[model samples]
Target: MITDDKDFEAKSIIARMQRIDKWPLPPSFLAIIALGYFFTFYDVTDIGFAMPSIAPQFHLTGSESLFLALSIGLIGYVIGSFIIGYLADRYGRYPMLILTMILMALGSFGDAASVNLDMLIVFRFITGLGLGADLNLIPAYIGEFAPAEKRGHLAQITFFLGILGQAVTPFVALAIVPPFYYGWRVLFLIGGLIAVIAVVLRAELPRSPRWLIGHDQIKKADDVVSKFENYLKSNGETLPELKTDDINKINVQTETTRLSFLYLWQKPYRLRMLVFGLWWGLWYIGNYAFLGDAATILSDSGISLASSILFLAIGAIGYPIGAISSWAISDKFERKYIIFVGSILWLIGMLIFGSKANSIALIVGSFIASYSLAFLIGIAYMYTSESYPTRARTSGFAMGDGLGHIGGAIGALFLPLWVAEIGFFGGFAFIGITTLIAGIILVVGGSIATRQQLETISA
Candidate 1:
């Protein structure tokens, strides 16, 4: 009788934890995290806009020098993603998140104050560390908190909002850079300020209940779950009563096992990891090749710098549009199919952009390409976040995303050389061909995960 009573109690607690899906979306939490993501996008995309002004000041005239200057940050991304992601899994999510925000703010300030190319590269590397951590951590945080039914929508929404920060960069650059060439420094300063603000806002948010459970912090997890239930009650929602046998079943199965990287490579997970790694690597190669050098690409094709910025700003509209489209269809469609189709669209767009130097083609092609990339990113975030168990989720995402950064770094380094050697048409053709190959791999190997709980998907 006593054994039966204890089992029932444990099951009830577990059921309550799972019932977090019934709570209202916490606006306060989402808003604060979204703010951090905003600064991340702002800091990253601002560099592309600032590069033209920076190149003249530092006497960096060669394509190789410019590519190196731009891509040096990605080296830091690899380090931070691998190390910090492991730490987040070991320590806790909230602390690591706060630390990343502080690092980002400091790095942004350092970049704004840099006096030379070497100084700028060092600071950009530091900023990349924070950005990499954000990329790995934010999605995990969102995934753990969101309900299965709405998980894709919530994650995609946050990602799209971050892209809004990217969209805003060109307009801010155009407003600041031409009149005062030194205005690029001010952009970094503003980004730093935003990070500081996000830190303050995020301080109020709670740690992940799912993470607490994975770590054997049962009492703390229960407390957090109760808070979520209370929040729902305050919103006038009723709680469902759980059966004692259901609770007992959950209790019997509950065990805290330390998940390591080796575990991720075991049966069922290895194939998923491969698909994720390939998708991330291939997608970013094309994405960075185009956006990282938008201004330069346009200027090389005979457009004035001023006109190029305007075109980019116009093309930036696609970011939000793509984000919205992804949000609408994320829950409705299988993620693997969305990714496959988006990749194909991106390939087509790149081909058009590379086909001719006509201004109309450049503007339209860039828009389509940018839109398709953002759409793919939205779905990718949803898929990756849900693909791993809570214990190893951030680590899995970081490893795969780190691979993507490697590709982005390579693209940044070599795409310019490709352009110099074979012209814009050849450069974009390279992007198109690579993207098509990636899409084919995804179609062949990727798993479909739609409207399923994270635990169920991982299992």
Candidate 2:
């Protein structure tokens, strides 16, 4: 009957998407979504910078509590990703995106107002939930819209802004923390206020037509794609005609739109989850050891808190530089090679960082680490996002990066306990080794998508 016409239209919408050569959406829309990406990465290091100030305020008793103060939100991140990822997959990205941002605003504001360690832990967990979910959605959302060849370049534009947020945090802390009694509170308050702004911005973000098509919302999906087609046509661009095969692949995908997080364990998806999950865990374990504990290591090495912040700030310059570099290289090169090289450099940077506690070595080493890690993540995130399909992409991302916070938490906790005995070189060596393993594993597992349509790659 005519009831099946929706399926035909849904498939056509996807065909239109695959044919467009350039980004079909307005540039400003992507810019707004990029702000969400910025804040998510920003919060990753915000607590680490705030830790020195936070520790004394609550009279924290041990390294365990100290590291926990730094890493506790990760637990919230894991939980939030699961909740929002599922909701986004089942319902849609737009609503879940707003929910995630609201959680961050509440959590950030809550952390600022906290009077004790317990209250801070609670609020931080709330913030992590939003961060975990928002990050889980952002890449998948971007991946759906970006042309296959241009995917990496477009994604980097948002991630580049994000790295700058992380880089800017140290200076934000230096400006705020050293001067005011509750400068740390003000720093957190800033995260909350900006998150509120992001929530407002989310209202303008459109749902992925790809997502709608996958769920058989054909009329709506076609409506979105037609607008983009018209937009491109108005600009005098000629979109290529779609072959019949381009639309056929989606028919298999449409019989049941009941995909869930658990479905990731099925044949095609199981290996992806295992491989990408390990990569995320490994990446976080190493990166967290440095990012979560960089300030602590510096402070322990006889650098004053202000000086620790300053040195970190000096290295933060590399974050933006590396992000820009990745933007340039991501499309032209195979991502696997890029990942392998970034890790080797990341290890070298760690070695340099650990060579001495003095400013000369700290600044140089930190800059290298900062730069390489930025590139590593930018490339790796795109690589991982490319592995999954529209139906499960958000949850798949949540599974990889959200739960990867646990690995990060472990890395953050491990260094404080060991750094005192093995010294700086010893601690970083462990992280470097861990990072190298992740890059190697990446070569053998999951999808290695480059210049391929998402539908074809996922299939």
Candidate 3:
């Protein structure tokens, strides 16, 4: 019995030693982040490709089809964002992420085999709930895990994959629609498959140590941090040294219980909530308006599915390219400035495209706008995440991003009707105005936020 006890003690000591040794980022964590973001993007783009096929199946008018595809998702997203955002703050980012993935996987599987428009709509709404959670929690989760300097680059990967997923949808539609009995159903099937894989991969990811610490699970949090550090050291990267002084800077005393929307409106947080909410709403309206309608608009220009798919790929490349470029310079300038420039460019491109309809110039203009919008959104993630105190980071992102989906729903539901009535030019012009106005508001709000110094809250 003594020998056995000695053996157990030795093992425990070795385990403790292993925890102290710093290590590089685990491949599992990176894979989980990638898979999670990839599906998020895939969900957003899938509806666009499915639109043509879905339109005929439901006997939906052009606008009705568009609304059916987008509005339901946005509604679910709005609810999910706020609910999960609050949950992440109260429970932990990791649990919330995993829960959402499960929700998304189930939603996708159900959607793939849905028999009617109503059932499909219900499943899509469920999928939107997952997407909403991702939009709210994933970036905040990534930000918490990443090194300060590397945060922008790592966070930008989510956007990069998002665009790639969007690009893949058009190609997928083109390839499968010809042979598949229902091309749109294939998109849902693909979504289900991706979600399954993502959920499996995500299950392997370690919970964020920061979240544990925030929740006052000190022993567990330290264990997680130690493991991450040891993993980094094994990979030849030194773990970041955490000084108690630095920890004190962001620490806030709380119940370590789950937070709610009510807390978001208290004191200084109220200002942030309002500002970010407006920003999100506007951003959504502007960005989705372009993305959801891109295929249809190009189709009107006599572009074949093949040409449209190729051009869409080319156009979508702008997102990653712009995001990467922004990352290179993100540390040099304030994030808000980058967003402003991108939005301004979006306005110019949209105006040029709308005014010069049915021409090569229009396509070029649209592509430029799409690229600029990606960069704008990339910057927005950085800005929004950075804008809040660490304790309420996920909540800030969720509430803001959730509110943005409201605008997105409006853009998605209405833009198609306007396009049918006024042509692509008019539709583009309308989005341009919305974006331009949003840009102005952000610029003004950012100034106010900077002056207020509420960005880095101390718990």
Best prediction by TM-score = 2
The TM-score ranking, best first, is 2, 1, 3
The better-scoring model by lDDT among 1 and 3 is 1
**Candidate 2, after superposition: displacement of residue 203 in Å?**
0.3
Best by lDDT: 2
Query: Model 3: which ten-residue window has the lowest total lDDT?
Result: 449-458
State the weakest 10-residue window (summed lDDT) of model 1.
248-257
Instruction: Quote model 2's TM-score.
Output: 0.96
- What TM-score should be assigned to candidate 3? 0.86
Task: Write the residue-wise lDDT of candidate 3 on 237-303 in tens digits.
Answer: 6534544344333323333334556666787667777877887787678678767766665665677
Per-model lDDT: 0.79, 0.83, 0.68
Cα-based RMSD of candidate 1: 2.7
Models 1 onward score TM values of 0.93, 0.96, 0.86
Give the Å shift of residue 29 in candidate 2: 1.2
Model 1 lDDT per residue over 170-238, tens place: 899889976687798998999999999988887887888667766656677678778888888889888
Global Cα RMSD, each model? 2.7, 1.9, 6.4
> Candidate 2 on 113-139: residue-level lDDT in tens?
999988998899899889888888887
